[model samples]
Target: MKCLLVSDSHGSETELSEVIERHRGEVDAVFHCGDSELSNDSSILEGVHTVQGNVDKPGEFPEDTAETVKGVRVYVTHGHLYNIKMTHIPLSYRAEETQARMACFGHSHHPTAFEDQGILFVNPGSVMQPRTRPEQTYAIASFDESGGAEIRFYERESAEEVTDLYASFPAGTQ
Candidate 1:
């Protein structure tokens, strides 16, 4: 399965639509990492999975979300409750409890993806308000019930993949 990962759009209807159109048939899922602040649009509800960010005025976004997509246990959160800007301790704890192979979160507006402690942590950066000496960025992930997962990060406008990573949990662990 392929998934488009986004975060911190802040409220860009056009960019959101661009994401949808860019990955239309390319991926099976589209995940908004956080900070969309689109409580009114709800178009996200159509073909995306999302979590509430610190700025989100919520209607139905869960603090933490878990979903099984194409046989992978995925975790979603805004990372504020996890104190992501400080560290991933809180998010790590939840991943252990959930046995989630992949955990996605956003708050720092930096695009990153990595593997540690048998879990994959991803932050798709601020697609709108990017920080930390980089252009606005987002990410995507592809998975199979095989050895590992492949993740890629891209500049929003050029769609240039600037970073890539591969993750594989130890044997007999998910």
Candidate 2:
């Protein structure tokens, strides 16, 4: 199954819409890791599963969410509550507790993709205000029932793959 992971768009509705449109038929699920700053009823978020970020209005969206897509358990959050800037330990623990195989989040505006234990943690970075990298980015993650997985980042503006930021995990039970 394939999923699109994006976060911290910070209210660039155009970019968010474009990114979602670009992968509309190519992915099975789409998740927005928060800070969208768009209204909950905005057409831009029509089909997106989003979480509430520190900057987003309280009760506008869920604090976190989980779902099983094509047999892959996914956990989505914005990360502020977990203090992600300091460590991923807290976030990882939450994902583990939920029995999720793929964990997606954003807050630091840094892109990262890696697998620890059996869960894959991905941060697609900030699509509007990037920090460590110049390019605003998002991610595409593919997983199979056999445990094989691959994560690739793409520049939000150009939709070009960020060749340097990619990860592939060996099949093992995810």
Candidate 3:
């Protein structure tokens, strides 16, 4: 299965719509890690799995969520409550408790993807306000039956793959 991971749009309807349109049929699922600053009923979020960010209004979106895709458990959050800017330890602990094979989050607006103790952690950066990187970014992750996964980061507007940001993990590692 293929999943599109994005976050921190901070209210760019055009960009979010463009991304959904671009990957609509190509991916099995779409995850919005939060800070969208859009309403829960926004058309742009029609089929997206989303969480709430610090800036988002409470009671509309969940603080965190989990989904099972192609037999892999994926945890999604906004990172504020977990204090992700200082460390991923808290989030990692949550992932472990949930038995999630991967965790996706945003808040630092830094595009990053890495594995620790078999679980993959990804931050797709801010699609509307990127930081710590020149280009705004998001990630596409593909998982196979054997449990192997590959993540490829891409420049948001251009939809260009950042080859150097690519990562691959063996089966069952996460």
Per-candidate RMSD, Å = 2.4, 1.1, 1.0
lDDT of candidate 1 over 3-88, digit per residue (tens): 88888898887887686678768887888877888874576546688888888886557677788778778898889888899988
1 against 2, candidate with superior TM-score = 2
| Candidate 3: regions farther than 4 A off | 172-174
lDDT of model 3, residue 154: 93
Model 3 residue pairs with clashes: none
- Runs of candidate 1 exceeding 4 Å displacement: 164-174
TM-score of 3: 0.97
Question: What lDDT would each prediction earn against the true structure?
Answer: 0.79, 0.93, 0.92
Model 3, global lDDT: 0.92
Please, what's the RMSD in Å of model 1? Answer: 2.4
Better of 2 and 3 by lDDT: 2
Whole-model alpha-carbon lDDT for candidate 2:
0.93
Worst 10 residues of 2 by lDDT: 165-174
lDDT of 3 by residue, 14-121 (tens): 998898889989998999999999999999999999999999988779999999987889999999999999999999999989899999999999988899988899
The best-first sequence of candidates by lDDT reads 2, 3, 1
Better model by lDDT, 1 or 2?
2
